[model samples]
Target chain A: MSDNQSSGPLVWLGTVLATCITLYLFQGILWLVVPILLSIILYYVTEPLVYRLTHHGWSRESAAGLVMGGLVLLLLAITAVTLPRFASKVTTWNEQKIISNYVQHGADFVESTLRTVEKYVPFIDEYMMSKARDNANWDEQLAKWAADNSSHTIMGLLHWIPSLLLIPYLTYFILVDGSQFKRFLVRAIPNAYFEKSLLLLHRIDDQVRRYFQGLMALTVIDAACLGIGLKLMGISGAFVLGLVIAVLSWIPYVGSIVGCLLVVLVAATDYASQTWMTYGAVALFLGVRLLDDFVFMPMTIGRSLQIHPVVTVLMIFVGGAVSGISGLLLVMPVLGVMMVLGQILGQLATNDRLTARYQFRKALLRARAQKGLEA
Target chain B: MLFSLGKKKNPRLAQLKGVSLFNDLKLSQLRIVNSLLHERNYLESELIFDQGDEGQALYIVASGKVRTHRDNQPEDKFVEFGPGDFFGELALLEDAPRSTSARAVEDTVLLALFRTEFLALLELHSSIGSMISYALARDLSRKLRKAIVSNENPTNL
Candidate 1:
C-alpha cells in the first residue's frame, strides 16, 4: 500500500494468490527450496560485513572468502566446544520418557478440569468420564507412533543433510559473485525497459533483504525478552526454553500455541506442588504477545511486508489450506517478494513508451533476420 | 596506481578512466566503478529519457552522440554530448524529475551509473566518492555561475 505500489487491490490480491501458489509449488521441491531459502537468509545476514571489507580496498572475492571462511571456522569452533556437552546432557535424559511424562501431565490437567466441571453438574457420571479417557489415549498413540517411526525419522534427517550442506558453498558464491551475476542478468534487458528493470531488481532485492534482517533482529529481541522474563520467574533452562520458544513462534499461530503448551507442560511437571508458576508462565507469554503486538511487530518484519492485517490472516489460512505448515511459515516473506514483483510488473505494463520501444526493437531484429532470407 | 596496466587488460578501463567524474581514481578503483556501469546501445532518434521522468542514473556517452532539449522545445535548441561527456548528473543526487529530455543523435553506446549504486559506492569508498562528488560540485557550480553571468549580461553565454 506504499505510494510506489498504488496499483490497487487487484495487485495485492494477485500478490497473495501468487504467493500461495508459489508456496504450494515450493513444498514439492522443499529439500532444494529449504536450503536455498536458508542460504539466501545467511547471504543477506553476512552481506554487510562482506561488502564493508570490499569497501576497505579488499577485492570482493577475497573479502567474501575471508568473511565466510572466518564465519565457518567460528561456527565449527562453537560446535566443537558445545556439541559434546549438549550431547552428553541429551544422552543423560530419557527423551521418550520425558515426552510421555509431559503428554501425560497435559492429559491429566485436562481430566482434572473436566472432573471439576462434572462435580458442578453431577448428572454426567464417572462411567461417562472413564469412556472419554479410554477414547482419548493420545499419549499412548503418540508413543506408539514415535517408537514405529524412529528409524524412518533418522533416514528422513539423513536425506536432508546433503542438501543442508550446500548452504555454506552457495552462500560463499552468492557473497563473492552476486553483483557480477546481477550484471549478467541486466545485460539481457533491452534499452527501453532497462532503467525500470534495473530499479525493479533493486527494489526486489531490497524488500527481501529488509524482511530477512528485520526477522533476524525480531528473533533476537524476542529471545532476550522471553529469556530474561522466564529467568526472573525462576524457570529452569530459561534461556534455552526462550530460544526454542522464539524459534517456534516463527510459524505464527500454530507455533505460539505449541510453544505456550510446551512451557506450561514443563512448568506443570517440574513443580507439581506449585501450580501458581504455570499460571504465571501463561501470563508471561500473554504479556510478551502483547508487547509483540504493540511494539516489536510494527518495528520489524511486519512493516516490511506491508500487507493489511485482514489479508495477511486470510492468506495464512489459504496458505495452510494449500501447503500446510511450510506454507504458514513462509507466507509473509513470499507475499512480500510477490507484492514487489507484482507492483513492478504492473508499472512496467502501464508504461507505453517502454513497451513501444520493446516492439520497435523486436521489429528491427526481425527486419535484420529477414534481410537476406526472402526469395 | 598505474592506468596502463589494467587498461591493457581491458580497453574500456581507459575509456572509463577519461570521464572527469572518475579521472582521478586509481586503475583498481576505476575497475570497481566500471563494474557498476550498465552499458546500453541506442539507435539514432531513440529517446534515452523523457522530461518530467524521475532520474535514477547519470549516463556517460562511451561512443556516438546524444542531444538534450527542454519540454516543448524545438530540436534546434539542444545541447550535444559526445564521447567522455556525461549527462543526467542531477539524478545521481536526488529523486527529482528530469528537467530535460535526452535522445540519441546517432547509434550510441552509453554507460549508466545508477543512484543507489553510486550512493553505496560513496558509503563504501570515501576517497573515490569524495573525488567524484567534488568534480560534480565543481561542474554544477561552474554551470550555475555561467547561468548567472548570462542573465546579467546578454550574449555572454
Candidate 2:
C-alpha cells in the first residue's frame, strides 16, 4: 500500500528525468528535427484521405502512395508556376528608383512626425532634431539590412532543400504504418494497464489531431484574409507576404509582432506618399487580429489546450530559449500532450479500482521476493 | 492449440458477421469495422482481463472458449463463453471498470475493437455508428430482461 502511494511521484520524477535527457540530446541534432516535425504534420494532414481510400477497398499502401504522389505533383506544379514570376518580382524590387523613392518618402514622413513632436514638447526638440539629422540615411540602412537578410534567407533555403525533400517520403511511411506502429505499442503494454494506457493514448491522439487541424485551418484563413486585404490596398506581392506571415503566426506571441512589423514596413515602402494607405494597412492587420482572437480561433480551436495564459507565455519563452524557432512552434502542442497525460495519470491515481490493483501487485511482488529468499 | 494457424480464409470478417454488435451493418460498413479490429492469441488459463481493470475495448472470441468470473462470488457462479460470443460491450460505450475477470478456458483467439478506433469509425460513417449503437442497446436490453426473469424465478437455471 505504501509502495503504491509512492509510485506516482516516482513515475513523475522519471518522466522529468527523461525529458531533461531528451532536451539535451535534441540540441545537438536540431537540424534533423525540422523534417521530422514537418513529416508528422504532413502525416496528420494526409492521414484521413488514406483511411477514406482504404474504405473504398484500396489497400493501405496504394492509398498512401496515391496521396503522396498527388502531393508531389501539386508541389511541383506550384513551384514551376511561381518561381519565375517570383524571380522577376525580386529583380524589379531591387531597382534603385523603386527602393530609393520609398525609403526617401519614409524618412520624410518620420522627420515630419518628429517635427510635430518637437512643436508640442520644446525641451527635447534639440536632441530629437540632432537624432533626426543623423538618421537621414535611414533608407540606405534599410536597403542594406534587406539585402543582407534576403541573401541569408536564400542560402538557408538552399541548404534546407535536402532535408525538405525527405518530407514526402517520411510522410508516406507514417501514413501507411502509423496504425500498425500504434498497435505494436499497445501490444507491448502489460495486460494490467493496457486499457488505461490505450485510453490515454487515444485521448492524446484525438486532441492533438484536432488542435493541429484547427491550426492549419486558422493559418489558411489568416493568409487569405491578409492577402485579400493587402491586395485591395494595392500592395504588390501581397499574397506571398501574407502567406509568410501566416506561417510565422504559428510561433505564438513573437509571430504576431513580427508579422505586424513586416506588414507596416512593406506598406510604408510601397505606398510611402499615401500615409492614409499605411494607416489603412495597419488597421487591416489589427482588424484581422481581432477576427482571429474573437472568431476564427474560438470556432476552429476552441479551448482545446486549456492552458493558462501565464503558463503559455512562460512555455513560449522557455521553448524559445531552448530550441529557437522550432521550439516556439512546438511548445504549445507539447504542453497540450503533457496536459493530457497529466490529467489521465491524475485520474488513475485517484481511481479506486486502479489503486487497489496497484496494492495487490505490490503484495504479489513482495510475496515472490519472500519465496526467493527462502529458497 | 488455441493459437493454431487457421485456413487461408480470413476468419476475422466471418467472425465479425456473427457478433451481434455488427448485425445491422452493411457489407461496406462491415469492412470498415473489420479494418479496425486487432487480433490477439491467448494461451489456456491466461488472463484476458482482471476484474476491476479499466475496460477500453470490446472483445469477440474468434475461436476457443473464455470464462468470466467475479472474484467476490463463488467459483461456480461464472459464465462460459464460446466462439462468436462478445464481452466487454460496455467498454465500447464508456471507460468503465470490468465487473468480472475474463480468462481463456482454452487456447483462444480474440478480436478486439478499441473504443478510440470505434469512435473514429463513427465519426467517418454515421450510418454504421447508428447501427452498432442500436444493436448494442438492444443486446443490453435483452440481457437485462433475461437477468430480471432469472432473478424472479431462480429455479429457471
Candidate 3:
C-alpha cells in the first residue's frame, strides 16, 4: 500500500509528460485535426437518433446509414434551394461602383461626425483629427488586406472541400463501431482501475456530447434571433448575415463583438441615408446579446464546462495564439475534457477500495518475505 | 465493414440461462444481457485473475473448466468450476478485491460482463434492471443460506 501510494504521483507526472509529447506530435499533423474534430461533433449530433433506432431493434450499422442518408438529403435540399440566390448575391456584391459609393459615403459620414465632436471639444481637435486620419487609413488597409487574401482564402476552401467530404464517412464508422472501440480501449486498462477508468470515460463522453449539443442549440437560436431582427429592420440578406455571425460566434465573447461590428458596418454602408436604421441595428444587437446572456446561454449551454471566467478568457487568447480560429473554437471543449480527467484522477487518488486493495497486497508480500527469512 | 458469415448465435446466452442470478430474466432480457458480454479465451493454467486484485466484472464459463484457490491455501485445496458456472458476481454490484484467484484448468472460453456496461443497460431499461437486481439479491441470499448451513455442519458434506 505504501509503495503504491508513493507511485501515484509518479504515474500522474508520467501521464502529463506523455500528453505533452502527444500534443506536440499531433500539431505536426494539424491539418487532419479539423475533419476529425468535425466528425466527432457530427457523431455526437447524430448519436441520440442512432441509439433510438437501435433501441427499436435496428442494427447499429443500419441506423447509422439511415441517419447519414437523411443528412445527405437535407444537404442536397438546402443547396438546391439556396445556390442560385447565393450566386446572385455574389454578382451584386462584385459591382465595384456600388461598393465604392458605400465606402466613400461611410468615410464622409465618419469625418463629419468627428468635425461635429471637434466643434464641441476644441482642445482635443488635434488628437481627434489624427484619430480620424488613422481610421481612414485603417479602412484602406483593411480593403487592401481583403483583396490580397481573397485568392489565398479561396484556395484554402478548395483544399478543405475534399477533406470535408470525409466527415460523414468517418462519422458513420464512429456511430456503428464506437462501442467496440470503447471496449478495445477499456481492455487496455489495468484490472485494478478498470471499472473506475470505464466510469470516467463514460462521464467524459456524456459531458462532451452535452457540450456539442448545447453549442448547436446556441448557434441556431443566435442565428434565428439575428435573422428575424435584421429582416424586420428591412436589411437584405438578413438570414445569410445572421448565419455568418452565428458561425463566427463559436469563438466565444470575441466572436459576438466582431459579429455586432459587422452588422453595424453593413447597416452604415447600405442604409447610410436612414441614420435611424443604424441605431436600430445596434439596438437589435444589444437585445440579442441580452437574450443570449440571460436566456439562451443558461438554458442551452448552462455551466457544463465549469471553467472559471478568467481561465476561459486566458484559454481563448492562448488558443488564438497557438492555432488561430480553430483553436479558439475548440479551447473550451478541450478544457472541459481536461477538467473531467483531472476530477477522475483526484477521485482515484482517494478511492477507499483501491487503497485497501493495495494495502492487502502489501501485507501479502510482507508475509511472504517474512516466511522466506524464517526458512 | 467486417461482416460475420451468418447470424451467429452467441453461445454464452445459453450458459447464462443456467445461472440462478439470471434465471428470472425473460429471453428478450437475456438477449439484452448477451449483447453486453465480451468473450475471452485462455490457455491451460493461465491466470484469469489474482487474489487481492480488484474485480470489475463477473465471469461465466462458456466452455472447458476453471480452478479457484486462495493464495494462502494448499495447492490441492481448490474448487473446480465447469461450463455454466459463474464467479465474481459481487463485482457486478461493487468494486472489491478478489477473495480467491482463478485460473483456467484447461484451454477455456469465458464470457465477461463488465459492471459499467451493466449499469448503463440498467439506466436505459429500468424494468429489466429492477428484475435483474431482484434476481441477483435472491441468488446472493441462497448462497448465504448454503454457506451458513455448511458452516454449521462441516461433517454433512
DockQ of 3: 0.15
When just chain B is superposed on the true chain B, each candidate scores a TM-score of: 0.89, 0.87, 0.83
The model with the greater DockQ, 2 or 3, is 2
User: Docking quality tier of candidate 3?
Assistant: incorrect
For candidate 3, what is the lDDT?
0.72
Instruction: List candidate 2 segments past 4 Å from native.
Output: A1-24, A51-59, A87-146, A345-375, B1-35, B39-55, B61-66, B70-75, B82-84, B93-110, B119-149, B152-157
* Tens digits of lDDT, candidate 2, A145-262: 6655664566677788888899999999888767766776667654445667677787678777777788888889999999999999999789988889888887777888988867
User: How well does candidate 1 match the true structure in TM-score terms?
Assistant: 0.87
lDDT of 3 by residue, B65-140 (tens): 9998888778897778898778777888877677788888987888788887778777666667778788777867
User: For each candidate, what TM-score against the reference?
Assistant: 0.87, 0.77, 0.74
- The clash number for model 2 is 0
lDDT of 1: 0.79
Which candidate leads in TM-score? 1
TM-score of 3: 0.74
Q: What's model 2's lDDT at A65?
A: 100
What are the candidates' individual DockQ scores? 0.40, 0.25, 0.15
Query: How would you encode candidate 1's per-residue C-alpha lDDT over A1-375 as one tens digit per residue?
Result: 123747667876788779978998999888888888788898998898887887778877798899888988998898799878865654544454555566666556656657777889788887887788778686577655644555565567769978987888899988876777788778887787888778778877887887788778788888888889889988878888888888888766677898898888777766665667777888888788788878998798776656666877787788888898778878766776787778887888778877887887678667767988967
* Interface RMSD, model 3, angstroms: 6.3
